[model samples]
Target chain A: MNEQMTQKPYVIGLDLGGTNSVFGIVDARGDIKATTAIKTGGHTTPESYVDACMEVLLPVIEQVGGLDKIKAMGIGAPNGNYYNGTIEFAPNLPWAHDTVVPLAQMFSERLGGIPVGLTNDANAAAMGEMVYGVARGMKDFIVITLGTGVGSGIVVNGQVVYGHDGFAGELGHVTMVRGAEGRLCGCGRTGCLETYCSATGVARTARELLQNTDRPSLLRELDTESITSLDVSIAAEKGDELAKEIYDFTGKMLGEACADFAAFSSPEAFIFFGGMTKAGELIMKPIREAYEAHVMKPFRGKAQFLVSGLDGASAAVLGASAIGWELK
Target chain B: MNEQMTQKPYVIGLDLGGTNSVFGIVDARGDIKATTAIKTGGHTTPESYVDACMEVLLPVIEQVGGLDKIKAMGIGAPNGNYYNGTIEFAPNLPWAHDTVVPLAQMFSERLGGIPVGLTNDANAAAMGEMVYGVARGMKDFIVITLGTGVGSGIVVNGQVVYGHDGFAGELGHVTMVRGAEGRLCGCGRTGCLETYCSATGVARTARELLQNTDRPSLLRELDTESITSLDVSIAAEKGDELAKEIYDFTGKMLGEACADFAAFSSPEAFIFFGGMTKAGELIMKPIREAYEAHVMKPFRGKAQFLVSGLDGASAAVLGASAIGWELK
Candidate 1:
């Protein structure tokens, strides 16, 4: 793929997830085109996973409209790293922990000659926000995504906190409740913020609220197997007291978590993204109200609350493109 | 000061408060053999303040040790900056406003050989914690001093986060309560973290607790002006329910505040210092318990709760010494 490319420089973006692989062609202005998504081979075999990724990527290149414009490729994985240019053990991916260079090598060979850069999805989101999202002009802010799980990315003094070993901004895992030690989490821990604040968290909370049974609700009519965060959102929007309470509880938790973040980085704002947050004001009102009740003073009127503007499927694509624009 | 002290390589530590000015000779290991405190001369004039500082310093230098051990100096003032080596508009001091090099010039003349470095009290405390306190091994931690007011010194990635403009860590001013705008603070802001979580915050809470009825104990027994944080701590220790409740409330708020911070820098711990923290387990237990109940998950069990081992008067000296050690 690289050998046939022309003189015009172009960039590629890759999003690595548990069930699917996505790649896109982007340019300097952050526009993404020719996006392709392929089923991620279960992480059982590393080589096959690489092959599946290449399968999705090559076609995206052809869709790049004009290959002459492609210059570099940026990969956004669960645990991608910038310094080492490798991904170790990412919990979401089933493959055994290993360096990600082999896959990059494959992509480079398949796509002809081009440079590849990498970073975690959260960091990529942070870069994306700085590059083209709400935090465009601000040097400091944190982005939190509430989806299947809650993921956070921190930007301090205009730069991301990658930690010494590249595991810095793990706010979702910061414990907020007692007995959190044994709670089941994707990271093998219990009571994670993600466990309580993500879409999954909302579902868990709804189940718990339903379990108590002291409170009557229309929720009982839904089939047990299909009740979801969307149902809760809709119910709350319809003024179901139980659903409202769940969102209030969840938003309060998210707000309190953001307040804790304010004390450390003193950023100018918190930008939120993800499907759960799509509940919009349903989740945001509680977060803002709770944040006001708990945030440190300097942070009170200073940090604004923002909802991400990235389109659903397009979110990861832009984040990947932003990674390609690293240090630009 | 900079030129003459090239070879000797020593630093001085000056702590200026509304009540007094302390001068000490600090060496490479953060040791202070000579230290002395003197009146600010109500020091209506900057020259008087400087002269008084030298008089107090010179005698102490001769009495306990000598000038031979000193090299340079670090000043902990209301608004000093090590970056600009200046004190800009110290709010509490008698001087009107915008004081800087004029004060440094006087010190250089008096010390005759040492240079001066400047930073606020909180930053100094953070440095002290990093070099001489429990935070010895951690690259990231927050040192919060719960004194007359709340002040925080933030160290991230092993260094202080001096924002792009040099005024980074201001945790106390972050508002925790919305429209809790009526409480008074030194910075003139209402509902500040300092208003709720400092030594003064304790007294303030006690006052609020005492509003409905007459408490028959130590605090009410003393003249209103004389009521101290120590008195409240004693009452809480003796099982005063109001005092216990006050601490519990504050702890919960602080825990939530810390949870917000967890989202930002993701520090390893938040080390408590200052007289109010002397409440010790009473304060720490609640803080830990509430922090666990409120902080972001990944930060749970990861950031420890502890008190500073450094003492009051000695901390500034040690911190100043650390400044020199770290720099020169």
Candidate 2:
């Protein structure tokens, strides 16, 4: 293994998203030496999906000095389980929605039995942050991905908390609103943190704000139904009051949710990831303020609030590749 | 250490309560060989407090074959920090109220430098459960102590989550109610789980139930202000409608809180400890029901809810002593 580590300086990373299966050959320093992609859809089964992936992935491996130079492979995918190295019942993946797909093993078998590791994308992001991003030196932190859905990866004592089941760190589904008043969530629940703080949640908030009040703002100029979180961010940057309020509402709830989280693990920091974090201090300031205001007195001002240090476009790939380095 | 483990067959356990400091000599099987107690409050300083504790503790040490037979000492106290082995600003301890007290180090110095460890009572309870109670052999579980105040010890991946500050697992302080309608907590926060779920919280619920409605029952037979959780339990045992309702309310809230907790670490079980658990299935039923009803679909029916296995009278001492085995 020591000899292998010296000879094989690269690892393959797969960021398996709903729309695209992106493959990157990453070095130890997180540099992408070669990359390729194929559409993640149109596969009838897990075997077919892997076949299609390999067609594009093989070229990248060859470009990175062939299979002998590759040490391992890692994958970041929705519903990926660290313990099982499988993607279980993922709603979005065409081939893995109902059955457990042994993805890491399949990849390992195809890649000449080099070890492969897999975990949910959020956990991958956390590993990326711990290795090459903002959480580099911290052992106790939470990486919260505020994307299409609010996802989380929890680290404690320098390891990801996989829980009794591999499906832990579902902070996005914690009920913020307890009763009938909560917004409906895609997970068949109501009032989840995801329903109020995800990218889609932010757009919904914009829609609700536009519908509930006649407040004059730049958001009113956009088509009400199609207003995305990005539109709200652009409007807020232009000093639009209502757009700023939308961020405040989202941030405040996020902060309050974090306050509850502090009572759970008291992480060293809360590292925000994904699209919603692009709002920057617009979202961060309110989260910090609400955390201080709502958290137990002992935890006040104890946690650092920061954004992911990994560049957005390559972060998922970097996060996935980081997992390869962890393979024994 | 192996030779010491064979020669020194006992560890000293201290359960430091606000009223009494109980000391016990415990063996590997959780048996108490000797025990004694002293009033915790008469001392004016931490030094004097330790001096007084030693007076009673030395006799127990002698009864258990002297200090040479003692491997280490463990203290379970309010606001105890595992990292520094100190009791920090514990309001219940007169000497430690406003000061950081190096109680563990002091004991170690007095006992010829045998290792000493200290942690908040909740974490100690968790350790106790893992080592000797219902959580034996379980790697992931939560031990919730529902005494006068609510407390918790969260174990993940077979380790107590002390967080970055050694002050994690404050689950009792998690907010159950989000808005102004939330109850005021002793922690200077509003709507904490402790405020609504502790033993005192149950009594408070009984009081509110009697006051809010004209329901005629055995609870109204006693003065409302003086009504204790014990009184409510006694009434409920006799099938008092209002008292049963009180347990239901408390259990429901606890269950809902556990549901939220499930989203955090996804423990295999939630072990109830301390006084309120005496309500038996009355409270446990509602908690399990609420947890299943409110938890995310994937987590439903996955976790077991159980009561502490240790005898209530000696559990705290055993919990403290269990920490001794973990020291390096």
Candidate 3:
């Protein structure tokens, strides 16, 4: 067989994060051949970001058989909206204004009208999971990213529920408690689900334990100032009772959060992704137990909680590419 | 202005409640011209229940041209699934076990194979609102029915979010509070959204107040057994502080629930229905204030909270008929 005939054609996938931009040349089968990274610079202008994205994707396209075989470019960023072809007010990515035009439009402008498409990184991960991961055969499930903050990518009836303004499926900001003394959230509120259950949430809980409660664990071995969610996970793996309790606590909150989400969406399962989800069963057991205990009876046995099978970095690129694949 | 030409084509709408069943013939624009009601017969047998529903709808439908001109029969039931054409395990209507198709088919056989579509009352209410009420011009909003128990139907990007098992949008049973105390829900859970914010929820709050706190109000003047949700609303209107507090508390919880839902579905507004929603500004003010305070900044000034214009009896038929409109 001729190597060139057997080889699959490539598309460019862009991952636009808060600080850096990651781009890759990927084939239909999700094989990443050429990759590049660039700083997003500051809130200078949308033109600068567009220039930066083109500069990064063009080189990768050139490296992998020039621009002709690069069928399309798929861009995935935080707050990306597929409907209006823009990203609306992402706090983390300090862009100059509220909405940014289709990263697809920018790609086509540079590449002489090649096809382009866009979606959020979280949503892209969901598409990636559908195309190439554990949820490959499933139509209903939630992809939860336990990153800097908790993010949800909901899939029901084989499509994402991007609501009226393309800002649907935000499950992290649900209220766990309401009165005073509920912890302050990053969004300047009290008792947000992300305030208690995400990695930053776990670290905050550990800090609170050191400051208020007298729990014995390896977590207390370090100064409260330096304790990390990783230390808590490590201690839990070593059979530290307090660490186990902490994980159980985190899992319990997440379980209840998943239950609430289950009530509204009635998904088949919830797939976990991002950093803190690495704790695995230590965090899963409590979540499952509480979820069953608290969920509506009909929804009790319907949803499963599991970790994602896609590599974090590769998943976003593949997810973005899936958008291009869908459109193409 | 002859009533003949403008007397739009009527479709038979059947509303199956927990205790009673009502049937009405509705014109194209949701005007209910004729209606009839019957007591729901004994429980624990599909034979009796199906007979009751058939008896309820058959006569009223016959009054309007013998079901020939009736485009379709739309039934608003509890736990009805639009996908499999079944109603599975409704708590209020417990005896209905996989009885949707048999009943619809039975009716269809009698009516010359006219289409019969069955869906849950909440979802039907959503259709009613979209087709006839406050949401008539909008494609995205959540319709919350604040009755004996809270119920919700969600619309996103011009479609409903029916989950993998056809049980999505059970918004009433979500665990809005983490670990709340008090009476258990019909589903054997504690702290459901309905447990705290429904008409029954308001009564629970009033009783708790009568037991726990010492404050002076017209509530004290009323007989304990005779106190009702209406008395509470009236008392609050008459400058009674305790009644005002009860409404304020319910409104607060409701607002928080809205903010949480906003994070999940990002609807443009919420349309309220059922008897309890008549509390009007007593409920609307607090919900709006809290939702504005708690929702994500981007979604902050985007969604509205409004009253349902659909009559209580007509809600069922209009909601179910909307599905036919959606499918057509």
Query: What are the per-residue Cα lDDT tens digits for candidate 2 across A211-325?
Result: 9998998988889999999999999999999999999999999999999898889999999999888899999999999999998888898999999999999999999998998
Instruction: For candidate 2, write residues B1-328 as lDDT tens digits.
Output: 5755567888888999989888889999899999999999989999999999888888878887788999899999989999999999988788889999999999999999999999999999999999889999999999999999999999999999999999999989988898999999998888889988998898888888889899899988898899999999999999998888888889999999999888888899999999888889989999999889899988899999999999999999999999998887
Better of 1 and 3 by DockQ: 3
Q: Estimate, for each residue in A1-328, the C-alpha lDDT of model 1 and write its tens digit.
A: 6765545445788887777778777666667767887776564767777777776666667665545567777777776766565666665566635434455555666666666667778887887788777888888788888888788888876777875445577777765553534357776556667889988888888888898777877777787456899999998888899999999999998898777666566677788988887788999999999888776553576678999867677778778777665534
Q: Which segments of model 2 are wrong by more than 4 Å?
A: A1-7, B1-7
lDDT at residue B154 of model 1 (Cα atoms): 86
Q: What lDDT score is found at residue A306 in candidate 3?
A: 82
- Candidate 1: where are CA atoms >4 Å away? A1-11, A55-73, A79-86, A97-117, A179-192, A210-221, A239-242, B1-12, B17-19, B24-37, B44-74, B78-119, B128-152, B162-314, B321-328
Tell the DockQ for candidate 2.
Answer: 0.85
Best by TM-score: 2
In candidate 2 the C-alpha lDDT for residue B119 amounts to 97
iRMS per model in Å: 4.6, 0.7, 1.2
Candidate 3 interface RMSD, angstroms, 1 decimal: 1.2
How high is the lDDT of residue A320 in model 3?
Answer: 76
RMSD of each: 7.3, 1.8, 4.2
- In candidate 3, position B268 carries an lDDT of 89
- Candidate 3 pairs with clashing backbones: B124-B319
**DockQ-based ranking:** 2, 3, 1
